[model samples]
Target: MTETFDLSALKQSLDAAPDHKNLKPLGLQTIYLGRDALTVLPDVVAAMVDATPALGPVAVLSDSTPKRYHAGDLLSFVTGCIDARHRVRNVTVGVAGHTVHADEETLAKAIRDCDGAACLVAVGSGTVSDIGKAVAAAQGIGYIIVQTANSVNGYADDRSVLLINGVKRTIPTRWADVLIVDTDVLVKAPVEMNVSGFADLIATFTAPADWYLATLLGMDDSYSPTVVGLARNQGSALLEAAPLVPQADPNALEQVAKTLTLSGISMGIAGTTAPCSGMEHAVSHLLEMATTKAGNETALHGAQVGVTTIVAALLWQRVLGEIADGGLSRVRVPGPAESQAAVLAAFHTVDPSGAMGAECWRDYERKLARWAHASERIELAKRDWPTHEGTLRHLLATPQSLVAALQSAGAPLRFADLEPSVNEADARWAVANCHLMRERFSIADMANFLGIWDDDLVDELIADAAALGSSR
Candidate 1:
């Protein structure tokens, strides 16, 4: 028997899913946080159709990979779900990427091809949703995300991460006004992918501490822990039910859908990725950019982030421990000149082999140059990290239900398992060079701020990390 999901929140979320809490819509958005909602696609569509004319002429844009996994059937399924009083003028699902191999041009063109799409429905996971959201945002249209898998937490995020010329980039895009998830499909998604999501969700614990650290330094902290707790709790519940998620059982479906929906809403609440990312996310972004360059689709985003989580978690622990030992002085963030020199030097050494194509590196430089001018005054590389490091340790070190869930679902336990090529050197190098990408200070800069950031230090750090690595 399938474990049943607690879907009591669907009614409330549906009635108010469109805008901010203060700008709630009136019965226009609908959500199905239950098992096999996809299989009952007809009902899903019917519920949507009757919800509002605003979504009836919805243009469905998706990457081909998710479409192959039944993303296209969603509109037809929803068409069947609605009452005869509701009418769907037509459901047009325009193919964006091929086999999830989406490109920037394809992503941009998909939105331009919206034709009669009044609102867009994203049918896949991260990649598909990114493309769909960008199109909607550029067109100033509303979007609904129908997640086919629990592979990411950007369902309701206003920003989308994209690959522009094989480089990872974050773009401001429209967030989903409505997030619809069918548990059956998510539980039955590729095992590695689901495990990856498990890792990403758990990283939330570590992420908020980093956010808090920045907030103390004067970054905005309007996001609430209460909203983040919703997703975190749901994620924990799903992890507890990890074994059942991949069984394609109804109970597992509900849990998967609930967690996924909660993740989406958390983005809505935070208005940022504070509820879902941190140094782990930063590391995965680097790996993903490299992977795209190598023509290697090695692992899912969550899987890579999972491996990075432990590394960041350990670094946070050690930094705090050192502070407790009273062996290190509190760090004042380096002056811009000093920090920039360190960042540039680290990137060169890490990229010595030129694994990243020249064109890609050139493009990155151009983008960074453009962004730096406006962001230079922000004092972006924060140095007072040990205190926040202690907080991150509290969040990442504890054995949460997420670790158990990913293990139950057969997710990776360590970096070696995910990237045999990633050695102690690679881990250290990635952390050391982490500064060039984001305008934020994370574990990478924290490691650099500490005196133990040499090759030998990095090696020692990785060795200790590998030794204490947990597959549980």
Candidate 2:
């Protein structure tokens, strides 16, 4: 099922890029790319063990999913160099590495219990990789990431976002010594996971707007066109491979998975989240953080991002049109006094905390107010304006027909199905608290800034979106 590609043409493209001067060592050193790549794990482990001799006491981080276990069959498939003592004395396999909830303490404890392992082989997608990355980095131990699902482009980056002190924070991490992916394993994953990955990938179209916005505000350093171009190309591949997204075609899944892997690495190269995320991601992060606080559990990371990507895409299109029609030039920058009032008006439009049932609303307001005081808040809003627009556009831009296309392909695009989560209130709360999540102003905040964020509008959109989801 491999969709054939011109390998020589790709090589020519690579060659045409001109043996550019090494720009500070780009990307992960170990790339286990290509189909059936995971079958070579033992040899890879043996080689790495030979190289980094200090790498001792291997602890394996595994997932509880049936898919990962099925994928483990491939790990077990590696014919040579099996060490029982290496596994028994040093191995700490956590079935809940990422699928369930293993915090820093839990994971560290597991590794420490395993005779103080020096390396952890993480055998799954983003979550497992994050845990492995964190466990290794925090303990001065290096780890390798085995990608199980092409769900998100998090594997290639040096940053690991985890719950340290009960709050999500991104800590810098080293790259995996080996980036392994059994294409066969990825092929067996639920098609929805693949589609969600694509939706997240397509978000690259809007991220440059974020970079442009950041630069316009004189905040960030230079934005790289090369990295952006790379992201967009990967995104395009995901779409082109959309038709072949199920039952894990080696050719199709390889295209999607490799693009996804490179997308993760692209973020690593960019040294910023902008390469793979935009306002859509911020919206997802806000909901995720809120759900965590609410004691709610179990929402797939990619699903939330997928839904928000749709919304952001729609909003982005709307804003893109306005900007193109001279909205930026026409609108004058309001004075701080006027700006404050407009923002406040926007806030109250959505928040009716004065009412009896608004105790929760008032408390959230306190937090929202604190977020507003951030020094760079307005600048992020102004600069990232168009990308925020693109995020909105992602919503309307992706036709329901496409969601159906994804559905026929087995993807989930609505909120109702996001397990560990079934509440629209979380989505509503996220939209309501838009201004609080990040400094980069998203469409939710733009709705407020543009005088469209009202209880009625928010209510209608959430209800309509959820209804659309339920219908699906």
Candidate 3:
């Protein structure tokens, strides 16, 4: 018999976890998810008022893009639900080009403009919600998310990915006080957006492996098998619902939305992004940086991540295959000086002024220091490769499997599928350079340090991905 996912019940269990108790008591206090979720907004707001007592005016932060349903515009649809007694202010963050970034300056401006607002209602997708969360945190105000699309997992996460000095960085932020997911609105979203959410959930197939690798190396002490297990429990169910995503099947959309939300909650429980993001996300971030630098439109974060997940899966397959074949050998790890030189050289082409290179190195340096400090654990991992090989293999999905899921979901499986299309050269560059862009340890970092992630290996992985995409 197949087990059904009851999000409310699962959340209760999570709330009782030892980790949740140890951390500051802050997260989604109420989550209303259903077809008529919007109708309950007034009740949710009233509950918020009763809880906070001194709550002031509510500021609804959103973008200029008009998200609509069969009834009408989403903004007006939402406003109609709020009680007449509540003081409400609508603020548009203003969009530019094809996307709106959750940048620091923009968030700072939002905080200043919405000053004195007691609570913020984030009324768009991931980016809007991220900005709202940051602004709320800065002003010590309550926050709620009226999710407009299931485009990304940041909707429920406590961390916001913001651009700092032109470099993308994930900083700590607060979670929403309430989350309202209206299926009527979600089903009206563009097919691509919903598919993107499915693709983001696909990262679960590979990300846990990277997190396990980090745990084995003793770099992150907060690793939790319980959290990973919670996510894995729903992995196959989400993939099974992929085909229905493009059709905007309400049930399927709700499943995807729930899985994405659970993925975020796993991160919240662990107090790190390790559970849901890994080398795959690093590749996406690198591509985002390059696209922004070229002044081109960037693909949806989950869409980019979906494609990169295949690459990361293939890399893991190759690494595990080699280990199983007894190809393990000791190689000298690069020191800080050598690693710094490589980082600068790799990023110099991306940013000639060395600003981006400097920013990357500043973060990469910490990773190197941790790697150096964990030499014993690394050695232990190398020594026990035989024992760990099966675990890695079981945790990751094949590239072909990932490609098929994306194809069924109507998501882009290759660079060509992305808007403004990332080419072969760009894809290869992202694969080769992603490890330098983030301080997190991932399979990319492992491959780089082990001297296996060279140009030839990158070409092999890219070719394999292309073959898989074409085969489907």
Candidate 4:
């Protein structure tokens, strides 16, 4: 039987864990989930006011897009709600754009401008919420999230994926003190947005395998089954609700929202994004960077992640096949100089000025150093590949399964299906160069270090993914 997740019960378990004392406080105090969740806005504000009696003005941060409901403007709606009860001044910080970026300049300006605000209530989706969290952390103020859409899992996470020096980096940030998910509001969001949210949650099926692989290779020591299992526990439910997402069914929207929120909390518990982001996320980030550098609009983060998740699943299947065929015994670790040269050369194609390349190497070198120091663990992984094969397979969904899930949710399952339309060449470029773009060690890194991911293998994986897409 599949396990059911109760956030309150899970929080209690986390608090009671023997290592709980060492764990950083998630800072998430309350979650208001249901229809009429917006009604609790005053209560959230009052709680913050009680905690910080001398709290300054409250800033409501949001994008310019209007929600598809009777109360269309999320920021206006929130401001009006807070104005009715609290005498605290509420200021609206509207980031100019339908889609705002989580970059250093934007965040710095938001933080500098909202310096005196004692509380921040994010009134949009993932990007707005992430900006609010970052600004709150910078200003040392409490934060709350009034989610307008089920778009991504960053809502409850303590980390923000910000662009630093043109490369996407997952930086530690603050979690919201309260998270409000109103199903009525979520159901009014664009169906595509809801589908993208479902797609993001689907990554739970594949990301944990990458995390487990990194643990086995000793590249990351912060792996936890408790945290990872929390997300996995909701997998079957999310998949069951996937087909109804396109219709904006309230039940389905609530299920997706709750699961995605739980996913962010899982990241908080693990103190890393590794539990929900892996090689697939690297692929999405690479594609986003390419589009941004080319002066084009990027696709939805979760949409890109969905398509890339299929690719990662296929690559893992192939890697496991190779191991089953005695490939692990033939694995050869590369020298530091060789790995650095490869990373640099791979990155030069993405950025000719070498700045991005240097930034990537700065991070990748740490993983390489860790791998060198943990040579014994590497040997153990090689010798134990067969023993852990079943567990790895269990953690991943098949390519066909991912494709069907994306299709059911009306998400982009292929490059051509993406918004802004990623072509075959760019998608291939992302698959090939994704490992070099991040310091994190994923299946891509493992494949590259083992000499398993080459031009021919990339072509094979691309062909396999394309076939899966066509089969849909």
Provide the TM-score for each candidate, comma-separated: 0.74, 0.73, 0.94, 0.94
Q: What tens digits encode model 1's per-residue C-alpha lDDT throughout 19-93? A: 335321222244555545445444444454455455436566554343223454544554444334343433223
Count backbone overlaps in model 1.
11
Top model by lDDT, which number? Answer: 3
* Tens digits of lDDT, candidate 4, 109-144: 788867777677888878878888888898888899
- Ten-residue region with minimum lDDT total, candidate 3: 1-10
What does candidate 3 score on TM?
0.94
Residue lDDT tens for model 3, 184-233:
89988888889888888889899999988888887667667678876676
Question: Which 10 residues in a row give candidate 1 its minimum summed lDDT?
Answer: 19-28
RMSD of each: 6.5, 7.0, 2.8, 2.9
Q: What lDDT does the true structure give each of the candidates?
A: 0.57, 0.57, 0.81, 0.81
Report model 2's TM-score to 2 decimal places: 0.73
* Prediction 4 TM-score vs. true: 0.94
Tens-place lDDT digits, model 2, residues 1-472: 2323343444345445533231223435566656656655666665655655464556666555545424256344432233533542333334443344445666576546533564567766576687677667766655677777778778877767665433344556766766776666777777667666765665565566656544443434555656666666655566667777766676677777777766766666666666667666766765665555445565666667766655665555555565656554443333445444443443343333422113223333443443344336444555766665554344233435445544544555666666655577667766655554333434454445445456676666566555555667
